[model samples]
Target: MTPFEWILAVCIAIMAATLLSGLVLVLRTSDVLARAVLADLIFYTMICIFLTWTLTNPTSIGYEVALLAAIAGGVLPTLSMARIISRGRR
Candidate 1:
């Protein structure tokens, strides 16, 4: 394998580890806030995985998808958290 492939593999490994740990945390934690944050982390990790894949393969489509995923990853959870907090106050 080339050096770039090795670097990509390492990145993939790190993203996998992060995803697994985040999943474990999400499962073990009862706190809504903690779970939400972990979920967000997992989302970003997934994006990073996509970006790495795109970089190694040279695909515009993958980059576009990654961008969309990144935006959703940040925005949807934030909107959900806002709704949760607002409702909790009622």
Candidate 2:
């Protein structure tokens, strides 16, 4: 395997571990806000995984999806959190 592949593998491993831990945290947390934040972490981790996978095997379709995910991933979480906080304020 190439050096780049080795590094990518290590990164993917780290991201996977992060996702797992975040999932566990989300499951264990009782607070809605805490869970929402952790869930956002989990979402980003998944996006990282998808981005990493594309590094190894590039495809035009996957590239489009990855870009879309990257953009929507940021907006959705922020909007959702804002909505959640606004509701809580009522």
Sum up the clashes in candidate 1: 0
Colliding residue pairs in candidate 1: none
Q: What is the lDDT of residue 33 in candidate 1?
A: 81
RMSD of 2: 1.6
Any runs in candidate 1 off by more than 4 Å, and if so which? 86-90
lDDT of 1 by residue, 47-68 (tens): 8888887777887588669768
For every candidate in turn, the CA RMSD to the true structure comes to 1.9, 1.6
Best by TM-score: 2
Candidates' C-alpha lDDT: 0.84, 0.88
lDDT of 1 at 20: 99
